[model samples]
Target: MALTTLFPPESTATPFATFATETAATPFATFALSSTEAAATPSSTIAPYATALNGVNQPMNILFRNAIWWGLGVLAMLILIIRLMQRAIAHSRHTAAMGLSGEAQAYWSKNRYSTWWKFKRHMLYAPLGKKRHNREIRLSSAGNIGTIPSRFHAILLTIFFLSNLAFLAFLDYSRSDRYSVLADLRGRSGVLAIINMIALIIFAGRNNPLIPLLQISFDTYNLMHRWVGRVVVLEVVLHTMAWAIVKHAATGWSGIWHMVGTNPFISWGTVGTVALVLILILSLSPIRHAFYETFLAVHIILAFIAILGTWIHCEVAKLPQLAIIKAVFILWLLERVARMARLGYLNYSLKGKAWTSATVTAMPGGASRVTLHLPRHVNVKPGSHAYIRFAGIKYWESHPFSIAWVEHKPIHEETLPRQEKETPVEKQLREPETTTDISFVIHAQTGMTKTLYEKATQCQPRQLTLNAAFEGPYGGHHSLDSYGHVVLFAGSSGITHQIPFVQHLIQGYNDGTVATRRITLIWIIRESEHLEWVREWMDLVLKMPKRREILQVKLYVTRPKNPRDIISPSSTVQMSAGRPKIGYILREEVKAQMGAMCVTVCGPGGLADNVREVVREVQDVSVVDFIEESFTW
Candidate 1:
């Protein structure tokens, strides 16, 4: 019996199987073929069973691949469903509490709906460990590695990773010959790699549609993107290795090199694989943080190379994975286009007017207050951030800054003629045009911020106006309007995030548009001079109608030069020396909790973590919700 007669090739298209079958007629094939046939199949009846098993193997491989894809879809849909349910419940509760007050409101605010809230606190909202979410775990003062994922993120990621591993490892290779098994495994890994690339692209995108639909933050999606990218890289390497091992075993290293050199398909595939490996190396936390701007530039360039390589590889190989590659490209292109469109819409002046202007004012505490006079009015929400670009400083660099204040001011002022004989028609026709002013307090750290501060300080008045552009008003859509009791915690320049929230809630309370009746703003600063950063804005907020009734301002100067320097100007706004006891304040607030308490922190990692710990401790005792506004990336 011949080798081809007993162990028939699974497919002529399979490289390994084809190579083996083409050489079966050689003299060495007969001895091994006869021994295998004698031992495995003594009877002719076994031939039908062997053929049947081979047929089942292909379908099983297909089923496994389908199952993995379906599993990912199911998991995403489940998460979406849960988020929708939570939103629906919150909306219903908000509607019910609309007109209720006093005891009735307190009755509604009680933890009667404890089951879902408890589940959220423990699972969906809980940190991996005690209140460490959003706080970057640094190896040293200089290196910021990034934060650990929350418990929910960790569980989902683990499940996804394990699913890929199980699919790769548990394939039925029992009845098939070694070459057939290798070919199937290679194909399986390659298919999964392409599929995973879809997720990698989708999650990494800033314009990911799932973000708004599922109510997941960009940070969470970013975390998913990183992990999914790792999975793709792993699969790519595995796919390449499987083919290389089989090719080397059959035709030696010389043949493998020859094929790589000669075959466009193999060459392009190798290019993509190598690019992915390089990406993995460059994306290490320390390297990524240390040289972020450089890393970002190289990362974008390498990503394009990898995508182009993969696309050409699939095209040359005539593989069906081209569909997924196309999807990835389309997603990336859409995100880029969307970002550009947003930038143009936000920063571009109408009717060929001058570009949007930014006034950079150097503050006392090594900070620059950037006030952008936009071309038109835009509704600014609390906690929103924008990526600002200073063309004069560095054209390519854009930094994310929390929007501290947004105001609409008349662009063109109407002046009455000095003569008393001004016509009524002229007076009636002259109306001032209004434009938006968006401001951000940028603390002088390294890179662009430091340069900005230095440039602003160089001016005689410590302020300079220059043409600037900005994209978005991203994030900050998180609402505190639904809660009756809201506590805002800010540390140093983190106060930028809280100021808008305070203003919004106070305004909402005045207008009777929000449920919030009690608002607490706690700011922790190193020096009292730092208070000048938002002095004008704070004065405006303080003087708003009925402000003193609902708002309480607590200023804690951590390193006050003198104890006497900490002076309370009013009973409502009190200044104290030293750091705040986070637990004590939280406990005191919860004791007089009004309704659905929201504790939000935007500050240093340690302060945020401290707030989180205290919030978690008192969650069971009151209707408390934790919202941490930190930009980990």
Candidate 2:
């Protein structure tokens, strides 16, 4: 009789007892359900030869797991070292470049040979093929299969995958009984799956320590997260298959079904495996992109069930991998708790419990501007972003938005408590009080954004205030202060990211603090009305000290009401009716390029990709560094 035939399907018999009996009846079953002697062993059954192989395999699993960490640590350190060296090499040049005349600027812009530039050209900056990486590969208009990873990222992933294959293949295959071999295979894959689960959790965290540690962008970490998750799923499938093959060899398909239904451990494992398969299917780019909100909710629920099932599976069997499962559970729990605590402190005031507030105003284009009033001061950096959670609309959802404007409103002494009588002059000499206002320009596209726009338009004056809380000032790890020449490319709402940098650099240029000598902003939009979106802020920027001497603005209107509507505001700020030639602009800029030019793009994938391609091509001709701002979920 098969194991399930021993009792009714609802039998309450202990797993230790049922498993012990199954091992006794079928010798081949020893590969899945351990010998009665091995109730103490974790996920694998122990055959005669397994007794010898188990000792060697368990230690190797730990070694291989540590090896993964060691490799990552080395890679992180290498990147850190490269950044430090670049800073040191540019330090003196930065000071010299800022003071140079126009003729001297041309001399400093000449290409200097560096062997490392090839690696940057081909691997670091290169796309998977000719030129299609950041831009999504679409089947039709709305179908998205997702963008490809960079060549360097692809290489690292391939090496990692091959290493996993090699680790699984590292076993000695001289055993006479093939069951022992399968048993060993089952043990190794199980360990790999559990260890990789921990990596998956780490990569997926919004506060991933690796991002700051390696100076890598969150987008790159997210890319690694998807691949690591796929690896975990693959190892899980292999582990399940090995168990089923051995179980069937012992008592046929009926035995496989019986064992799965009869034992608690087996049942939980089967549930977990099935959940993982479903997750893999739904997480495909088409489904995930099309129905993102539903996908997110279902994805989390299934992942929780999967983790819970496997945790109990290992616990009941007293499996060695149980410790790894516990680690995974604890890691996930800690991140969630940390996020909750941060939100509490950041959102609500401790004294009055007054939360942060938001004012949403419908802008000229299909966009809404959210202005947050905070109770205290926050020093926002250029190139930084925050996660905004708006109440009464997607209350549980927090989306990352670039901080476009930050203003601190100081409380005058006239409004403050008069502890002691002070003259107006003395009061003005005191330090300024610090209440803050931060604003984000959000383009209405889907789900939460679309609803926000609709709601704001319903109210009079096309504006409404709502309860809101924000979570961060994450990112901003990059700085362009050391570059003598800088070019910023923005499309539509992307001007939000570039504005803060523009203001900071201009203020710095007047102060003679930063090395920046020249700055150019290229903004591309569909309609001229979009200019109304940032007109107020751009007006203030235009009037900055020495702005006319150092900054130039180029506005590209892809489609406009009339050609005259695209007229230049001033000599410093010019306008065009059609698209700007990406290659031609870069070539002209390079001719007069100052020492160490840097090109930055924050826009749609197509715009960013085009800018990236031009930057890569001009690298050999001139030293142009490229940085793209991307926040892919």
Candidate 3:
């Protein structure tokens, strides 16, 4: 009945085929048991190996399989649901704030198809679609929240990272002369260490959630991460030590390395051990990592080398399984390279000028602005940012800068490369532009901005060449739609991100698309030197007839000796004191603006953190209503 039968089924075969010929009767027709089998019968002989399972092994295989299933199935599903709910909450808050009633928002949310629409928008970055398809989707859902990475990623990585912990713990237990530690335990520990090491590398190479968290705060997680690393290093040490001790008790240290190096199972592991030790040394101070930038570069290069060594150590057998493990790293590397390529192309080719040039102009306080001129049309929204690199002076590394605004700019046309199936006319429109221009406001610090500030003050606005790369229009302040008044608080260089937002809000009011809420800008600078950068923009905005109806600007300089020294608009809400804490404002000023008021703050980390804490303490509102960008690394 089957299309092809390569072999006969066991159920249909004769019973004699199940037994070995040697174990059967000598004569095929005779029924007689062999002497060896008769002696080994349960009533005749006792068994020894049958006790090993209950004696030592704990049925780990069955337990581990069950754990894995529960983790991958039930846990993963819950995480997926959590991600969906978070996004739904954010969307509902946004829509409801636009004057929609709770029932109406609920009705919109009830549509199950909208979840699929959201999923499509989030996953547009996946390479399943053609170039034209991607372009169309990018246009349609321009401001959708990108993707929230799957939480199962964190769960799986935690399992692997913890597995390494278990192996290390076992190794330590065996080494401590504890009753639980024995020869068999040592052997099991070594095997588990090897298995966990291989698994850690595999999980790590797949862009695990832990990687991004590490990049952001190495210190917070470094203790646990380092403990695991030390364990792996120690396992290699103990594995070698255990074998060497046995051999040395018989032959001494003369043949230790030779015996260890000759073993195919551990030869590559020996090399990997040396590499890990070297890495541990370099990771410490006096060698490097004291400097942040240099530390990051060296750390990345050494980490890759360490991972390579680990892979080589595991692949001694040259098995297909090991080859597949190595291939995962190769694929991950390729994906990262692809991401870099896409980012580079987007940055280098903006409109047609090849690069944007800027000149640093001093502001009233310690702040400075670098004005940029574009060769052609380029469009970026208020919250959008571009990575900018200036000519000469450490321009090799580009840093992110929020787009202030373009005085005159055109609507950008979305361009797509012509497909093989497209008509020729469509191809003409898709031809790439040669260049474009953009500007960035640099908040002077110790490194790149320090150099820029010196150049700006010492010389003319030099004809600088810079490479511009764009990343996102990711976040915006709470819109003015629901709020009766919008209050924006920015400190020093923080205004670069906030100023454009205010402009966008004012325009929203002017267009009458949303409520004409009052707009208040509070800017705090340590000194008068930084105010020069915004002097022109503040003048222009104040002069506008449309802005006159709603906008108010307040500037506070902490070092002001007299009231006249402050460079702020007329009728400013000037305060004289030490730095103003958000908590103070919440207790004193927020009561009057409590209802239908949305507060947005973007500043240095300390101020931003304070604002968030204050808001949480004072208001019982959803997280969607209060937005803060600290720009903390």
Cα lDDT tens digits for candidate 2, 1-633: 554343223233343343332113344344333332233243333222222123234445556767777877787788889877776666766676656643465645656666656677887888888787788878988887788888889998998799888877765466445665665677677778888888788877778777776668888877887888788888889878777776677557896788789778778988988888888889888888888778878887888888898898888776667878998888888877888887887677655446889999998888999999876656788888998888899887778899999876554536544664442232333333545689999999778999999999999999999999988778887777767789999988999999999998888787776778789999999999999888889999998879998899999999998888878878989999999999999888887787678899998888888888888887788778888896455
Model 3 is weakest, by summed lDDT over 10 consecutive residues, at 48-57
Candidate 1 has an lDDT of 0.77
Query: lDDT per residue, candidate 1, 263-356, as tens digits?
Result: 7777888899999999999998999888888888888788888898899988765565677798888888888899999888877767437578
Clashes of each: 0, 1, 23
Tens digit of per-residue lDDT, candidate 3, span 1-633: 431142122122222222223222232222132222222222221121111111111223223323444654574466556555645654554444445322233332232454443433333111222211111112233222111111222344466557545533432232222212222233333444443444334333323343232222122133234444556566556644554454454345664555456754345555656666765665443333224456546655755665565467546433222543465456547646754664555444354534445555644333457655544334555655555556676755555566665454322434423363242232244223312334456777666777766666665543233333343323332344545456677877778777777776666666554443566677887776566666566665666557765666666677765656654335644444346655666544354342244567777644554554555444432211345544432
lDDT ranking of the models:
1, 2, 3
Error of 3 at 323 (Å): 6.5
